[model samples]
Target: MCRLTRLVACLLTLLFLVSCSSHSTQREAQPGLFLSSNNLPVFMSSPQVSFVLITKIQVPVQEGFDQEARLRNTLAVLTEMAAEVGANAIIVTNAEEFAAAYNRVSTGTHFLAGASFDLSPDAFKHVQLKAQAIYLNR
Candidate 1:
Protein backbone atom coordinates (compact mmCIF):
# COMPACT_ATOMS: atom_id res chain seq x y z
CA MET A 1 0.00 0.00 0.00
CA CYS A 2 2.83 2.45 0.80
CA ARG A 3 4.62 1.60 -2.45
CA LEU A 4 1.48 2.37 -4.46
CA THR A 5 1.12 5.75 -2.76
CA ARG A 6 4.74 6.62 -3.50
CA LEU A 7 4.35 5.67 -7.15
CA VAL A 8 1.25 7.81 -7.50
CA ALA A 9 3.02 10.77 -5.96
CA CYS A 10 5.97 10.39 -8.33
CA LEU A 11 3.75 10.26 -11.38
CA LEU A 12 1.84 13.33 -10.29
CA THR A 13 5.06 15.22 -9.74
CA LEU A 14 6.32 14.37 -13.18
CA LEU A 15 3.07 15.45 -14.80
CA PHE A 16 3.12 18.73 -12.94
CA LEU A 17 6.65 19.47 -14.04
CA VAL A 18 5.86 18.88 -17.70
CA SER A 19 2.69 20.96 -17.58
CA CYS A 20 4.35 23.83 -15.77
CA SER A 21 6.90 24.26 -18.54
CA SER A 22 5.85 27.73 -19.61
CA HIS A 23 7.24 29.03 -22.87
CA SER A 24 8.90 31.92 -21.11
CA THR A 25 10.49 29.62 -18.59
CA GLN A 26 11.87 27.22 -21.15
CA ARG A 27 15.61 27.55 -21.84
CA GLU A 28 16.27 28.90 -25.31
CA ALA A 29 19.32 27.99 -27.35
CA GLN A 30 21.54 30.23 -29.47
CA PRO A 31 20.98 29.99 -33.23
CA GLY A 32 23.64 29.44 -35.89
CA LEU A 33 23.73 31.84 -38.88
CA PHE A 34 24.63 30.22 -42.15
CA LEU A 35 24.76 31.40 -45.73
CA SER A 36 24.54 35.04 -44.88
CA SER A 37 26.51 35.44 -48.09
CA ASN A 38 28.24 33.25 -50.61
CA ASN A 39 31.09 35.52 -51.58
CA LEU A 40 32.45 36.58 -48.23
CA PRO A 41 35.02 39.34 -48.39
CA VAL A 42 38.51 37.86 -48.52
CA PHE A 43 41.67 39.28 -46.97
CA MET A 44 45.07 37.85 -47.69
CA SER A 45 47.18 36.81 -44.74
CA SER A 46 50.32 37.86 -46.66
CA PRO A 47 51.23 40.21 -49.44
CA GLN A 48 52.24 38.04 -52.36
CA VAL A 49 51.95 38.47 -56.12
CA SER A 50 48.57 37.23 -57.30
CA PHE A 51 48.16 35.84 -53.82
CA VAL A 52 45.55 33.17 -53.28
CA LEU A 53 42.72 35.29 -52.08
CA ILE A 54 41.79 33.65 -48.79
CA THR A 55 40.21 35.24 -45.81
CA LYS A 56 40.87 34.85 -42.15
CA ILE A 57 37.28 34.22 -41.39
CA GLN A 58 35.10 33.38 -38.47
CA VAL A 59 31.62 31.90 -38.72
CA PRO A 60 29.95 32.49 -35.39
CA VAL A 61 27.09 30.07 -35.69
CA GLN A 62 25.86 26.66 -34.52
CA GLU A 63 23.92 26.38 -31.36
CA GLY A 64 21.27 23.94 -30.24
CA PHE A 65 20.43 20.42 -29.13
CA ASP A 66 20.21 19.03 -32.64
CA GLN A 67 23.93 18.73 -33.24
CA GLU A 68 23.79 16.68 -36.43
CA ALA A 69 21.34 19.04 -38.07
CA ARG A 70 23.28 22.10 -37.04
CA LEU A 71 26.55 20.61 -38.31
CA ARG A 72 24.97 19.78 -41.65
CA ASN A 73 23.71 23.32 -42.10
CA THR A 74 27.07 24.78 -41.08
CA LEU A 75 28.98 22.54 -43.48
CA ALA A 76 26.67 23.47 -46.33
CA VAL A 77 27.34 27.12 -45.76
CA LEU A 78 31.11 26.58 -45.78
CA THR A 79 30.90 24.51 -48.93
CA GLU A 80 28.96 27.21 -50.72
CA MET A 81 31.49 29.76 -49.60
CA ALA A 82 34.32 27.64 -50.92
CA ALA A 83 32.58 27.05 -54.25
CA GLU A 84 31.77 30.70 -54.67
CA VAL A 85 35.43 31.63 -54.40
CA GLY A 86 36.51 28.75 -56.66
CA ALA A 87 38.81 27.64 -53.85
CA ASN A 88 40.40 24.22 -53.71
CA ALA A 89 41.57 24.15 -50.10
CA ILE A 90 40.53 25.28 -46.64
CA ILE A 91 42.42 25.32 -43.37
CA VAL A 92 41.04 25.85 -39.93
CA THR A 93 42.35 28.77 -37.95
CA ASN A 94 40.06 28.30 -34.98
CA ALA A 95 36.82 26.70 -33.91
CA GLU A 96 34.24 27.59 -31.34
CA GLU A 97 34.30 25.91 -27.92
CA PHE A 98 30.64 25.57 -27.15
CA ALA A 99 27.61 23.69 -28.33
CA ALA A 100 24.52 25.79 -29.00
CA ALA A 101 21.38 24.85 -27.20
CA TYR A 102 17.90 24.34 -28.72
CA ASN A 103 14.60 22.74 -27.94
CA ARG A 104 11.99 20.68 -29.76
CA VAL A 105 8.67 22.24 -30.62
CA SER A 106 5.65 20.20 -31.62
CA THR A 107 2.33 21.01 -33.24
CA GLY A 108 -0.75 18.88 -33.41
CA THR A 109 -3.13 18.13 -36.27
CA HIS A 110 -6.39 16.29 -36.53
CA PHE A 111 -5.67 12.62 -35.86
CA LEU A 112 -1.96 13.37 -36.09
CA ALA A 113 0.84 15.69 -35.04
CA GLY A 114 3.65 17.48 -36.85
CA ALA A 115 6.59 19.57 -35.83
CA SER A 116 9.76 21.38 -36.86
CA PHE A 117 12.31 23.43 -35.03
CA ASP A 118 15.58 25.39 -35.41
CA LEU A 119 18.33 27.01 -33.33
CA SER A 120 16.95 30.13 -31.67
CA PRO A 121 18.46 31.63 -28.56
CA ASP A 122 16.16 32.71 -25.82
CA ALA A 123 19.24 33.78 -23.95
CA PHE A 124 21.91 35.05 -26.28
CA LYS A 125 25.21 33.18 -26.32
CA HIS A 126 28.29 34.76 -27.79
CA VAL A 127 30.03 32.33 -30.15
CA GLN A 128 32.57 32.77 -32.94
CA LEU A 129 34.59 30.65 -35.39
CA LYS A 130 37.85 31.67 -36.96
CA ALA A 131 39.74 30.23 -39.91
CA GLN A 132 42.83 31.21 -41.89
CA ALA A 133 42.28 29.52 -45.22
CA ILE A 134 44.17 29.62 -48.51
CA TYR A 135 42.08 29.17 -51.59
CA LEU A 136 43.89 27.96 -54.66
CA ASN A 137 42.26 29.27 -57.81
CA ARG A 138 40.63 26.43 -59.66
Candidate 2:
Protein backbone atom coordinates (compact mmCIF):
# COMPACT_ATOMS: atom_id res chain seq x y z
CA MET A 1 0.00 0.00 0.00
CA CYS A 2 2.70 2.43 0.90
CA ARG A 3 4.68 1.59 -2.19
CA LEU A 4 1.67 2.11 -4.42
CA THR A 5 0.94 5.42 -2.78
CA ARG A 6 4.47 6.56 -3.28
CA LEU A 7 4.37 5.51 -6.90
CA VAL A 8 1.18 7.43 -7.46
CA ALA A 9 2.59 10.51 -5.81
CA CYS A 10 5.72 10.22 -7.86
CA LEU A 11 3.70 9.96 -11.04
CA LEU A 12 1.64 12.99 -10.10
CA THR A 13 4.74 15.02 -9.43
CA LEU A 14 6.27 13.91 -12.68
CA LEU A 15 3.14 14.88 -14.54
CA PHE A 16 3.04 18.27 -12.91
CA LEU A 17 6.64 18.91 -13.75
CA VAL A 18 6.16 17.81 -17.32
CA SER A 19 3.10 19.97 -17.73
CA CYS A 20 4.91 22.95 -16.37
CA SER A 21 7.91 22.41 -18.60
CA SER A 22 6.45 20.95 -21.75
CA HIS A 23 7.50 22.13 -25.18
CA SER A 24 4.62 23.96 -26.77
CA THR A 25 3.23 23.15 -30.18
CA GLN A 26 0.36 24.88 -31.94
CA ARG A 27 -2.63 22.71 -32.82
CA GLU A 28 -6.34 23.15 -32.44
CA ALA A 29 -7.50 21.01 -29.55
CA GLN A 30 -10.59 19.83 -31.38
CA PRO A 31 -9.92 18.28 -34.76
CA GLY A 32 -12.54 17.11 -37.32
CA LEU A 33 -14.88 19.98 -36.46
CA PHE A 34 -14.69 20.92 -40.14
CA LEU A 35 -12.74 20.01 -43.19
CA SER A 36 -9.17 21.21 -43.06
CA SER A 37 -7.95 23.29 -45.96
CA ASN A 38 -4.31 22.29 -45.82
CA ASN A 39 -4.46 21.53 -49.56
CA LEU A 40 -3.37 17.99 -48.93
CA PRO A 41 -4.90 14.86 -50.42
CA VAL A 42 -7.58 13.62 -48.09
CA PHE A 43 -10.90 11.83 -48.26
CA MET A 44 -13.98 13.53 -46.86
CA SER A 45 -16.07 10.69 -45.54
CA SER A 46 -15.66 7.25 -44.08
CA PRO A 47 -15.39 4.47 -46.64
CA GLN A 48 -15.89 0.75 -46.76
CA VAL A 49 -12.18 0.22 -47.22
CA SER A 50 -9.92 -0.96 -44.42
CA PHE A 51 -7.24 1.08 -42.66
CA VAL A 52 -4.00 0.76 -40.76
CA LEU A 53 -2.75 2.89 -37.87
CA ILE A 54 0.86 3.79 -37.56
CA THR A 55 2.46 5.19 -34.41
CA LYS A 56 6.06 5.92 -33.64
CA ILE A 57 6.32 6.73 -29.94
CA GLN A 58 9.92 6.23 -29.04
CA VAL A 59 11.48 6.71 -25.64
CA PRO A 60 14.86 6.69 -24.05
CA VAL A 61 15.82 3.59 -22.11
CA GLN A 62 16.34 5.24 -18.76
CA GLU A 63 12.95 3.95 -17.73
CA GLY A 64 12.52 0.23 -17.97
CA PHE A 65 9.90 -0.78 -20.49
CA ASP A 66 8.21 -4.16 -20.59
CA GLN A 67 7.95 -5.31 -24.18
CA GLU A 68 4.54 -6.83 -23.62
CA ALA A 69 3.20 -3.70 -22.00
CA ARG A 70 4.69 -1.51 -24.70
CA LEU A 71 3.10 -3.64 -27.40
CA ARG A 72 -0.28 -3.43 -25.69
CA ASN A 73 -0.08 0.34 -25.37
CA THR A 74 0.99 0.69 -28.99
CA LEU A 75 -1.91 -1.48 -30.11
CA ALA A 76 -4.37 0.51 -28.07
CA VAL A 77 -3.10 3.78 -29.51
CA LEU A 78 -3.33 2.33 -33.02
CA THR A 79 -6.87 1.11 -32.50
CA GLU A 80 -7.96 4.51 -31.30
CA MET A 81 -6.25 6.25 -34.20
CA ALA A 82 -7.82 3.92 -36.73
CA ALA A 83 -11.24 4.36 -35.21
CA GLU A 84 -10.94 8.11 -35.49
CA VAL A 85 -10.19 7.89 -39.23
CA GLY A 86 -13.35 5.93 -40.05
CA ALA A 87 -11.52 2.67 -40.12
CA ASN A 88 -12.46 -0.53 -38.33
CA ALA A 89 -10.02 -3.01 -39.74
CA ILE A 90 -6.24 -2.91 -39.78
CA ILE A 91 -3.67 -4.80 -41.82
CA VAL A 92 0.07 -4.86 -42.40
CA THR A 93 0.88 -3.02 -39.19
CA ASN A 94 3.88 -3.85 -37.10
CA ALA A 95 6.68 -2.45 -34.99
CA GLU A 96 10.35 -2.74 -35.77
CA GLU A 97 13.62 -1.87 -34.08
CA PHE A 98 14.45 1.76 -34.50
CA ALA A 99 17.62 1.86 -32.42
CA ALA A 100 18.89 0.46 -29.16
CA ALA A 101 22.16 1.41 -27.57
CA TYR A 102 22.61 1.70 -23.87
CA ASN A 103 25.18 1.93 -21.12
CA ARG A 104 24.98 0.11 -17.79
CA VAL A 105 26.56 2.18 -15.13
CA SER A 106 26.94 1.45 -11.44
CA THR A 107 23.57 3.12 -10.86
CA GLY A 108 21.17 1.81 -13.51
CA THR A 109 20.80 0.54 -17.03
CA HIS A 110 19.52 2.56 -19.98
CA PHE A 111 18.18 1.54 -23.38
CA LEU A 112 16.13 2.80 -26.31
CA ALA A 113 12.98 1.58 -28.03
CA GLY A 114 11.16 2.53 -31.21
CA ALA A 115 7.97 1.41 -32.98
CA SER A 116 6.20 2.03 -36.29
CA PHE A 117 3.07 1.21 -38.29
CA ASP A 118 2.30 1.21 -42.02
CA LEU A 119 -1.09 1.17 -43.74
CA SER A 120 -2.00 0.38 -47.34
CA PRO A 121 -4.96 -0.91 -49.32
CA ASP A 122 -5.17 -4.39 -50.70
CA ALA A 123 -5.98 -2.88 -54.12
CA PHE A 124 -7.27 0.24 -55.84
CA LYS A 125 -8.18 1.81 -59.18
CA HIS A 126 -7.15 5.16 -60.66
CA VAL A 127 -6.41 6.39 -57.20
CA GLN A 128 -3.08 7.37 -55.73
CA LEU A 129 -2.01 4.91 -52.99
CA LYS A 130 -5.63 3.84 -52.47
CA ALA A 131 -5.02 4.00 -48.73
CA GLN A 132 -6.51 5.71 -45.68
CA ALA A 133 -10.01 4.39 -46.23
CA ILE A 134 -10.08 4.48 -49.99
CA TYR A 135 -13.41 3.08 -51.14
CA LEU A 136 -14.84 1.42 -54.25
CA ASN A 137 -11.49 0.28 -55.56
CA ARG A 138 -11.95 -3.46 -55.31
Candidate 3:
Protein backbone atom coordinates (compact mmCIF):
# COMPACT_ATOMS: atom_id res chain seq x y z
CA MET A 1 0.00 0.00 0.00
CA CYS A 2 2.86 2.39 0.81
CA ARG A 3 4.51 1.68 -2.56
CA LEU A 4 1.22 2.34 -4.35
CA THR A 5 0.79 5.64 -2.50
CA ARG A 6 4.28 6.77 -3.48
CA LEU A 7 3.65 5.91 -7.13
CA VAL A 8 0.38 7.87 -7.12
CA ALA A 9 2.09 10.85 -5.52
CA CYS A 10 4.82 10.83 -8.15
CA LEU A 11 2.28 10.69 -10.94
CA LEU A 12 0.32 13.59 -9.37
CA THR A 13 3.46 15.68 -9.08
CA LEU A 14 4.33 15.09 -12.75
CA LEU A 15 0.82 16.02 -13.75
CA PHE A 16 0.96 19.23 -11.74
CA LEU A 17 4.27 20.21 -13.33
CA VAL A 18 2.89 19.62 -16.80
CA SER A 19 -0.19 21.70 -16.02
CA CYS A 20 1.95 24.61 -14.83
CA SER A 21 3.91 24.80 -18.08
CA SER A 22 2.85 27.53 -20.49
CA HIS A 23 3.08 27.88 -24.27
CA SER A 24 2.56 31.13 -26.16
CA THR A 25 1.69 31.24 -29.84
CA GLN A 26 2.21 34.33 -32.02
CA ARG A 27 0.18 35.17 -35.10
CA GLU A 28 1.89 35.45 -38.44
CA ALA A 29 1.09 38.30 -40.83
CA GLN A 30 -0.81 37.41 -43.94
CA PRO A 31 0.86 37.86 -47.32
CA GLY A 32 0.46 41.23 -49.06
CA LEU A 33 -0.88 42.79 -45.86
CA PHE A 34 0.77 45.19 -43.48
CA LEU A 35 0.13 47.08 -40.24
CA SER A 36 1.22 50.70 -39.83
CA SER A 37 0.92 53.23 -37.05
CA ASN A 38 -0.14 56.83 -37.74
CA ASN A 39 0.67 57.74 -41.35
CA LEU A 40 -0.93 55.80 -44.19
CA PRO A 41 1.40 54.06 -46.61
CA VAL A 42 2.44 56.23 -49.56
CA PHE A 43 1.55 53.46 -51.98
CA MET A 44 -1.90 53.29 -50.46
CA SER A 45 -2.44 56.97 -51.23
CA SER A 46 -1.50 56.58 -54.89
CA PRO A 47 -4.35 57.00 -57.36
CA GLN A 48 -3.34 53.77 -59.07
CA VAL A 49 -4.10 51.76 -55.98
CA SER A 50 -7.43 52.54 -54.36
CA PHE A 51 -8.58 51.26 -50.98
CA VAL A 52 -11.84 50.91 -49.13
CA LEU A 53 -12.38 51.12 -45.40
CA ILE A 54 -13.72 47.91 -43.90
CA THR A 55 -14.19 48.63 -40.22
CA LYS A 56 -12.68 50.37 -37.23
CA ILE A 57 -10.95 48.31 -34.55
CA GLN A 58 -9.99 49.04 -30.98
CA VAL A 59 -7.58 46.80 -29.07
CA PRO A 60 -7.36 47.06 -25.30
CA VAL A 61 -3.90 47.08 -23.74
CA GLN A 62 -2.75 44.02 -21.86
CA GLU A 63 -1.22 44.56 -18.43
CA GLY A 64 2.17 43.11 -17.45
CA PHE A 65 3.51 43.17 -21.01
CA ASP A 66 6.41 45.44 -22.01
CA GLN A 67 5.84 48.28 -24.47
CA GLU A 68 7.38 46.50 -27.46
CA ALA A 69 5.62 43.25 -26.67
CA ARG A 70 2.34 45.10 -26.23
CA LEU A 71 2.72 46.78 -29.63
CA ARG A 72 3.55 43.48 -31.30
CA ASN A 73 0.63 41.76 -29.61
CA THR A 74 -1.67 44.60 -30.54
CA LEU A 75 -0.59 44.48 -34.18
CA ALA A 76 -1.05 40.72 -34.25
CA VAL A 77 -4.52 41.00 -32.81
CA LEU A 78 -5.44 43.81 -35.23
CA THR A 79 -4.12 41.87 -38.18
CA GLU A 80 -6.10 38.82 -37.21
CA MET A 81 -9.23 40.87 -36.76
CA ALA A 82 -8.74 42.61 -40.10
CA ALA A 83 -8.04 39.35 -41.94
CA GLU A 84 -11.18 37.82 -40.45
CA VAL A 85 -13.22 40.55 -42.09
CA GLY A 86 -11.28 40.31 -45.41
CA ALA A 87 -9.26 43.49 -44.89
CA ASN A 88 -5.79 43.58 -46.42
CA ALA A 89 -4.23 46.42 -44.44
CA ILE A 90 -4.49 48.25 -41.12
CA ILE A 91 -3.75 51.90 -40.36
CA VAL A 92 -3.52 52.85 -36.72
CA THR A 93 -5.40 56.05 -36.01
CA ASN A 94 -4.71 56.81 -32.38
CA ALA A 95 -3.18 55.49 -29.16
CA GLU A 96 -4.48 56.78 -25.86
CA GLU A 97 -3.27 56.14 -22.34
CA PHE A 98 -5.28 56.51 -19.17
CA ALA A 99 -5.60 55.27 -15.65
CA ALA A 100 -7.79 52.28 -14.89
CA ALA A 101 -9.16 51.35 -11.49
CA TYR A 102 -9.30 47.83 -10.11
CA ASN A 103 -9.44 46.02 -6.85
CA ARG A 104 -6.29 44.58 -5.31
CA VAL A 105 -6.56 41.68 -2.94
CA SER A 106 -4.06 40.46 -0.36
CA THR A 107 -4.29 37.40 1.79
CA GLY A 108 -2.26 36.21 4.77
CA THR A 109 -2.34 33.44 7.27
CA HIS A 110 -3.49 34.75 10.57
CA PHE A 111 -3.22 32.34 13.54
CA LEU A 112 -3.13 28.60 13.23
CA ALA A 113 -6.67 28.19 11.94
CA GLY A 114 -7.56 31.70 10.79
CA ALA A 115 -6.75 33.80 7.73
CA SER A 116 -6.69 37.49 6.90
CA PHE A 117 -7.78 39.16 3.69
CA ASP A 118 -7.48 42.76 2.60
CA LEU A 119 -9.01 44.43 -0.42
CA SER A 120 -8.30 47.90 -1.72
CA PRO A 121 -8.88 49.97 -4.78
CA ASP A 122 -5.88 50.64 -6.99
CA ALA A 123 -5.18 52.47 -10.24
CA PHE A 124 -3.09 51.16 -13.08
CA LYS A 125 -1.87 52.45 -16.43
CA HIS A 126 -3.98 51.49 -19.40
CA VAL A 127 -3.75 52.05 -23.13
CA GLN A 128 -6.14 51.73 -26.05
CA LEU A 129 -5.48 51.53 -29.78
CA LYS A 130 -7.82 52.66 -32.49
CA ALA A 131 -7.36 51.70 -36.11
CA GLN A 132 -9.04 51.32 -39.44
CA ALA A 133 -9.03 48.07 -41.38
CA ILE A 134 -8.92 48.56 -45.13
CA TYR A 135 -8.88 46.53 -48.33
CA LEU A 136 -6.68 47.72 -51.18
CA ASN A 137 -7.42 47.49 -54.87
CA ARG A 138 -4.30 47.47 -57.01
Candidate 1 per-residue lDDT, tens place, 70-135, comes to 554554555455444444334443433423221121111111123224323422223343444344
RMSD of each: 16.6, 15.8, 11.2
TM-score of decoy 3: 0.44
lDDT of 2 by residue, 1-138 (tens): 999999999999999998863122222122232222232233334445543332212222222254344344434443344334433333321122212212122112332233112211211111111113111223
Q: Candidate 2: minimum summed lDDT over ten consecutive residues — where? A: 122-131
lDDT string for model 3 (36-61, tens) is: 43333322122355767777676654
Clashing pairs for predicted structure model 1, backbone only:
29-121, 32-62, 63-100, 64-100, 64-101
Q: Which stretches of candidate 1 lie over 4 Å from their true place?
A: 1-53, 62-65, 96-125, 136-138
Off by over 4 Å in 2: 1-65, 92-94, 98-138
Please give the lDDT score for candidate 3. Answer: 0.50
Best by lDDT: 3
Reference-based TM-score, model 2: 0.27
